[model samples]
Each structure stands twice: as C-alpha cells, then as structure tokens.
Target: MTILLTVLGIALFAFGLLFSIAWHELGHLSTAKLFGIRVPQYMVGFGPTIWSRVRGETEYGIKAIPAGGYIRMIGMFPPGEDGRLEARSTSPWRGMIEDARSAAFEELRPGDEDRLFYTRKPWKRVIVMFAGPFMNLVLAVAIFLGVAMTYGFATQTTEVAGVQKCVIAQSENRDNCAAGDPVSPARAAGLKAGDRITAFDGRPVKDWATLSDRIRDTIGPATLTVVRDGKEQVLHATLAKNMVARKDADGEVVPGKFVPAGYLGFAAKTEIVPLSLGASVDRMGDMIQNGVESVIAIPQKVPDLWNAAFGDGERKADSPVGVVGAARISGEVMNLDQPTTNLVAMFLMLLAGFNLSLFLFNMLPLLPLDGGHIAGALWESLRRNIAKVFRRPDPGPFDVAKLMPVAYVVAGLFIGFTLLVLVADIVNPVRIT
Candidate 1:
C-alpha cells in the first residue's frame, strides 16, 4: 500500500509541475496573441521536439526537457546590419527602422506599417512581458485563498502552551541538555506555561518577533514580565548560551558556525479561524509578500544553511530534492491518520508557497529567465531612444542569445544544486509529526 501511495503521489506531483509550466508559458502566449504579436510557436519544455503539430499560424509542441516552456515570436530582436533589406526596393536602414517600429505596435506586421516590438511604447512592452510573472502571482493568490477558505487558517496566540525539558538529538540518542535540562528561562523567571509574555527587559513584547528580538539582543540575564492568572509579575533568569540549528522557510539548513544563543523551549497555543472573504484576500497578499521576501533573501542565507547542515552534525548535501522530494513529502502527509480536508489544505498551501518561490526566482533579472528577456527588452528600448535623441546610429536591442554562456553556467550550478538537495532529502528528510 505504501508503495502504491508513493507511486500515485509521484504521478500527481509530476502532473502538477507540468500543469504549472504549461500555464506559465500560456500566460506569455495569450498576452502576445491579445496584443496582435505574431507567435510562430508555443511549446512547453525545451530541447528537441518530442511531438509537434501546426495549428493555423502557430506550431504547438512539447520538448524532451521538462524544465520550462516558451513562445517564439518573430522580430523579437532588431535585425542585424547585413544590408539584406537593401536587396529589396526599400532602403536597408528604412527597413530596419520600420521593423523596430513594427516590433512595438502589435497591430503592424513586418511588412505592414511600423508596428514591430521595437516601435511599441516601453510601458506597453513592459506590461506585455510582465504579464507572465504576474499571472503566476495571481495563481498563487488564488490557491492560497481557496485553501485558507476551505480549511481555515492557523493563528498563533501569545500564550505559552507546553515546555519540553530536554532537547533530544535524534541521530546520537543523547540529550542536548543532560543536566536535567535546566528550567526554561521563562519558567525560571517565574513565567508558567499559561503565562503571556507582555514585556521583556522593560520593552513591550507584543508578539513572537518582539519576544524573540528581546531575547536575541540581550547579552546576559534579563527580566521578563508576564501576565499570569490575569496579574503581571516580573521573573528573573540568567540567559545561557546554547547552540541551535536553524532552517529556512524552504527547509534548507543555514550554513554557519554555531553561536551560543539564548534558549527558549516553549510552544505557543495556536487556533484556527475561518476568515472572511476580505480577510482571506488580505492574508493571501501578506503571504505572497512574505514568500517574495524569503526568495530575495535566499542567497544571503546560503552560508547559514550550510553551517547548520555541516556544523550541527547534519549532512549538508543530503537535503537537496527535485520533484521526487515533493512527491515523498506529499505522500507522507497523505498517509497521516488525519482528516483528509486538513491534509488537502496543507498540500495546497505547500504548492502555493512553492509556486510563489518559483515565480519570484524566474522573475529575477538574470540570464535564461523570463525576467532576463524583459530586462533585455527594456534596455534595448532605452538604448534606441537615447541614440535617436542624440542623433546617433541606433545601438540596437539587447541580444538575449548573447547570454548563452551565462545561461550555461547557471544551468550547471542548478543541476549540481538539485542533485545535492535530492541526496540530502533522501538521507535526512525533514519530518514533522
């Protein structure tokens, strides 16, 4: 049964991934068509075509590589100065200028009035290119809203729930705090499980962030004021340094040396609240923003992840995973003896969050990405306008093909990283129970 469930989960995950890639490419194709741009081909995946069929003016197909998809548009870049246009009745320079103009005005084809991509206004072109990423963002928001409305949302309260005495090392079967796991700082300072931390070191502690900031910023002993049984009381405890491993939102370990840190082994009381339509939308926006911020911060946090994976006696490279990792996780979640609705909701949330990360990563203004093309388009537009105003020859559009080398380097790095993650996931998958 487990084997069958795992196989089914893998199949479902692959289906979802393909659907996402196709939808993302469809966004670009649809927008281009709406703007009257000539799309010669719309294909999902890359490499040699596995299957293809021509429909009207567009060739639809699938490629062997399942990495991504694209829509091939004519005159995507300015024509080279080969003087080929001069062979025709029109002057070469005049033809080049007309092609540039036609590139911008979606209404005009190559031979028609100057309506090329280059001729279109920058803002319009920006919108057309930006629509693809925007669509992904929209899909994420929809997924989040649907899941949250169906299963409600988890809300953590300030009240403390439980405190575990000793932190166990799973690999070595040793207690991290062998000396009877000294009383938690909060408990030692007179705060009980139900106590609400109202303030720390004389600063107001409104939420988890405030409480964590107070603890981390403090060098030594501190006073914590808590509301217990409806009365505020001051508790005193000396903060001791302890080593703790940290993981990012994506479950990747932060590479770094272990720093002696204040320890607090406490869980918060969390409740689920059914959100109103407006609240769901607001929460979805907040989640999307948080996801974007996390994606932007990944590069900076890589070192920390590495440290946690290696320094904490955890295998660093064992955490890498591809679609197989997603399948395993989803399968595990499904096998849990819980309400199917909850499981489905969790899966949806995970998918939405993952999609948000993928969307943001692809939109980075780097080579071999959708954002790179958009960046090239914008740069070319700027360069051409500047040259025209200065009465100089057109500098021409930014050639995305020129970034092939950089794209190759990025692809190599990604391949290596994916393998590493896959190994890590197989050997030491993160589990929550």
Candidate 2:
C-alpha cells in the first residue's frame, strides 16, 4: 500500500508540474496573441510531441519529456544588418546568432510581417516576455495565501505547553532541577500548563514571538493576563534574568549562543493555526525573501553540494532539492502517518514552493530566460529615449539575436548545475524522515 501511494504521489506531482509549465506558457501565448504577435506553438514540455492539436494559428501540445516548456513566438529575435535573415556563417559564434535568428522566423506565415514579436513596441514586448514569470508568481501567491489563510500553518501559540519546576540557565544544557536551582517564575506564580496567555502587562499579545520578546526584555515584577478554565485571570510573577540562548531576528533560538535575558519559564504550545489576510501576506513576503536568498546562496553552496553528491558527506536538511528530490519528498509526504488535511497541505506547499522557485529562476536577466527578453526590451527602450533626447536618428530595435552566444553559455552552465543537482538528488536525496 505504501509503494502504491508513493507511485501515486509521484504521478500527482508530475501532473502538477506539467500544469505549472503549461500555465507559464499560457501566459506567453495569451499575451503574445493579445499583442497580435503570432505564436506558432504552445508546448508544455521538451522533446517529441506526445499530443497536439491545431488551435487557430498555434499548435497546442504536450511533449513526451515533462521537464520544461516554451511558446514559439514568430520573429522572437530581430533581423541582422541589411535585413539579412538568410545569413550563412562559418564562424561558430556567428552560427549561433544566425541559428537563433533563423529559428525565430521559421514559422513565419504569409501575414506575419506586422505580427512579428520584435515588431511590437518595446513596452508591449516587455509585457509579452514578463507575463510568463508573472503568471508563476501569481500562482505561487495564490497557492501560498490559500493554504496559509485556510489550512493554516504550524505555529507556536501563546498557550503554555509545559512549565519548568525550577530555573536552569538555558546555556547550562541541563534539564534536571538541581539542589540549588531557583523556583521558576511560572511555577512560583502558579502558572500551569494549558493556560492561554492573552497579554503581557495588559498589552495584548496574539503570537508566541511577541510574548517571548516581552518576557525576554522584562525583569522584576510583571503581570500576565491569562485564561484558565474559561475564565480570564491575572497572574503576577517576577521575571528572572538568566543565561538564555540568543534569538535571531526571526525569533529562532541560536544554538550555542547565549546571552543574558529574562526567562519566562514556560514553553509555547505549537499547533496549526489559520492566519488573517494581512498575516498571510506577511508570510508570503518572508517566503519570497527566503527564496531570493536561497537563489543568491546557490553559488556558495556548490562545494557543499559537490561533497554531498560524490563524497561521504551528510546531506543537510537545508540542501537544495531538485525536481527528483521534491517528488520523492512528495511521495514520502503522502505515505506519512498524518491526517489527510496535513498531507494535502504539505503537498500543496511543495507545489507552491516549486512555482515560487520557477518565478525566481526565470526572472534572472540572462539569455534564454523570460527575464533576458524583458531586459532586452528595457534596454531598447532606454536607447531609444536617449537617442530622442540627443536629437539623433532612431537606433531601432536592439537585436537580441546578438546575445545568442551569451545565452548559450548561460544555458550550458544552468544545464550543468541542474545535472549536478539531479545526481545529488538521486544519490543522497533529502528525505522527510
């Protein structure tokens, strides 16, 4: 049964991936058509076409390999000097430029002269290129907000889970109540487990982080508004200064890093709790920031990735996960001994994260990416404006075809990195268990 569920989970993840790819392409297709740019093919994958049908001027289809997708817009790249679309070049770099320019016009129809993508205004071209990644971002935001506001997140609440019998400095790394240990404030104040702290000194607190910060910053006498047995009650306690683990900006305790802070003597209860729309947006913002940071840190992590892939190194939990790794995790998530809602939430969150990563990856202003084309259009716009300011002749469209060589190099590096990640995923996969 577990094996069957795992297979089913993999299939489901693949379907979701295909849908995301198709949705990304659909953005390009729709925006291109809206701008009167002729798109010949809207493919949801690479390699040979598995299924296809003619829709208007476009061949909409799914390819056998469900890796990535594209939409072939007519005249994606501008022509060379003297309208040289039929250039034959022996130079390798020149061949790449010519090849890209030639492929852009291969599907040119009888009436596609005015409908070419490069013929559109710079702003229109920018929108056409930006639409793809924007769609992924939209999908990511929708999924994240939906899950966060409805299914909720695993969060530490203001409710007390446990009360310590005696005060022990967090830096001491000991749990026992020793002979000379002081009585904990919570225990001395008669604060028990299951008590829901509503406020700190009449200042209403909704989350654990706020309560913790308040407790940490406080010393001497303090009052807590708590609810016990369906009745609101006030508890008086003297917060004690102790050596506690220092908390980072995100309120996560830093291990092995101690500082003098007021100790509250109670642990927050953790549970799944839904968030408001404002809180959901804040959470989404954090996710976006973290995703950006992860992308920025990828280069620095290459050595560690290499070690984990080929050496007898530990595959850290925070290691980068490729498609294979993610799918395997999805399978494991499906087979986890959890409730149905929890499992579905985990799977959906994984899909949402993939979409978010897609948005970030494709938005890189390098060749062969949606961002590269957008950058080209923006650069073109900048040049035309500068020319107009100086009263010079129009510089015309920036030939993005000239950057084909650069794009090739970028694509090669990306492919190599992807393959490395793929190998690591297969050999030392990051597992939930």
Task: Give the best candidate by TM-score.
Answer: 2
What is the lDDT of every predicted structure here?
A: 0.65, 0.92
Model 2: which ten-residue window has the lowest total lDDT?
78-87
How much lDDT does candidate 1 score?
0.65
lDDT of 2 at 257: 99
Clashing pairs in 2: none
Query: Can you give the lDDT of residue 171 in candidate 2?
Result: 80
lDDT of 2 by residue, 382-425 (tens): 99999999999999999999999999999999999999899999
**Backbone steric clashes in candidate 1, count:** 32
- Residue 64, candidate 1: alpha-carbon lDDT: 86
- Scanning candidate 1 in windows of ten residues, the lowest lDDT window is 80-89
